[model samples]
Target: MLRAPGVYRPRADTRLLVEAIREAALPRGAHVLDVGTGTGVLAVAAARSGAAEVTAVDVSRRAVLTAYLNTRMRRLPVRVERGDVQDPSETRQFDVILSNPPYVPSEQPRPPERGGARSWDAGSDGRAVLDPLCVRSARLLAPRGTLLIVHSALCGVERTLTRLRRSGLKASVVARRAERFGPVLRARAGLLEARGIIEPGQRHEQLVVIRGDRPEPLEGPEACGDGT
Candidate 1:
């Protein structure tokens, strides 16, 4: 896979997300959306997994171009767009949504305006992007759609599942892997320990893939809200 400078390179998290998508066993004609598609890895996986339509979105120009090139090179039917998934104007829903968004907690007040850090840096608690994504997930999904998102356990996996459930989706952890702290996270170990987000001497973080599923509407009387 060709990657532009600073774009997120496919790693364990990416591989896990791909695995989750394949296990989903979605119908062939399903529409799929890949948000924060750094290198289009997940988008390509969705296409190969049988999605009839695949849309990949990213906020970085280089990432958008990289994704387009990768998909185009593979001759996959993926639409690459330089846009934010959290945008309100994005009303088109999909049968499956894949996201490996920014989850690294940073002391910065906002995500980076440019450079590689933008791909993984999220404000303070790391929920800067995660929170919004969880809140907007169900809206972006079509009925019976599935949302596959990967993030470090340091970001609070339960918080993500809880937020998704509150959005009316059935959410759960689909995959997890413990990995030694990478350069980025390793550099923040002191701060993380100080903040109590991780135990002192912790040199590993568990990455988790959370699946949020939007269920189909109930039939008959169940469809009616409130017995009254």
Candidate 2:
């Protein structure tokens, strides 16, 4: 139940993440990592779907607290931490990794509700946080692991793929919502325009879920009796 403009809502992208993870068919009791788990929705989903362990992390203290309470209320075995993805000391890898990161491009005014830009804005080009996130993900994921991210299509899916490749990961788009949403990719567009990178009215796109895999192929999880 992440309220306001940028925080992730459980019913929104969590369903996409859960369905994808369930389809992966990992062995029972496998470890799953949920990054930027605002309300622990995806973390809880991973637990419900039979993940042996679910570790969630968020940069915001409030978000961490909320997720902690939610997980406690549900009695789910999830470890919630208040930390930034950029920290080098962050360890604890996993078989599966899912993230609904702050993909909104920077330069956009912070929403009045104040979930705080830390939960959203990706910096002047929107790639600030995304780049580091992907880089760290490459090192953090276990061999033959999978990483899923839901972001704006306007952020240059092709560029994201290129970055993933550079990070030694193969990227793919699992789902996309075709509609107008400036809050998603406006920063990339703005930055490009400022640099004469692209012209205005370039037909921005909508939201999309991106899945990147390491060089080692992921072994689909074994089906649990009640994954449906």
Candidate 3:
């Protein structure tokens, strides 16, 4: 797959999310959406897994192009767009939503709007991207749909779950892996220690994949109806 230097490369986190996708066991012909699709890896995976429609969105021009070209070359039917996931092209809902957005904590005050860092540097608390995703993404799912997201546990897994649940989805950590600090985090270890995000000398952090499921609508006797 072609990728610009500024695009997020498919790595362990991406592969882990893919595993979770397969485990999701989406129904045939399910519509899927991949937010922050750097190379459209999840988008392609969804198409290969029998998604009826695939739509991918990213804020970077290079990322948008990288995803578009990758899916195009594979002859997959994917609609790659450039924008926020909140403002997708249409009002359609998806049966499955996937994301591996910027979650690495950084000293940067705000998330970057461009460059490769945009794929990982999420901000001082690492919730700049996560916060919005947790708060707004549940509405994009169809009834009984699922949303899968992966990020470093340092960013606050509980907070993600709380936000998703508050948005009406049942959320929980579905997968986790302990990984040594990568180059970025290693470089920021001092900052992490100073902020008490990690213990002084901690060298590893947990990566987690969280799944949020939207319940089917109430029906029959349990459903609220107009007072008779």
Considering every candidate listed, which one attains the maximal TM-score? 1
lDDT of 1 by residue, 83-171 (tens): 89879788898999999999999989789888999889999999899988877777878888889999999989889987787777788
Better of 2 and 3 by TM-score: 3
lDDT of 2 at 156: 69
Query: Which prediction has more favorable TM-score, 1 or 2?
Result: 1
Per-model TM-score, in order, reads 0.94, 0.77, 0.92
Global lDDT of each candidate: 0.88, 0.69, 0.85
Off by over 4 Å in 2: 1-15, 108-115, 180-204, 217-228
Residue range 78-120, candidate 2, lDDT tens digits: 9999787668786767777888877555665432234566666
Sorted on TM-score, highest at the top, how do the candidates line up? 1, 3, 2
Which sections of candidate 1 miss by over 4 Å?
Answer: 218-228
lDDT of 2: 0.69
**Candidate 1 — which pairs collide?**
none
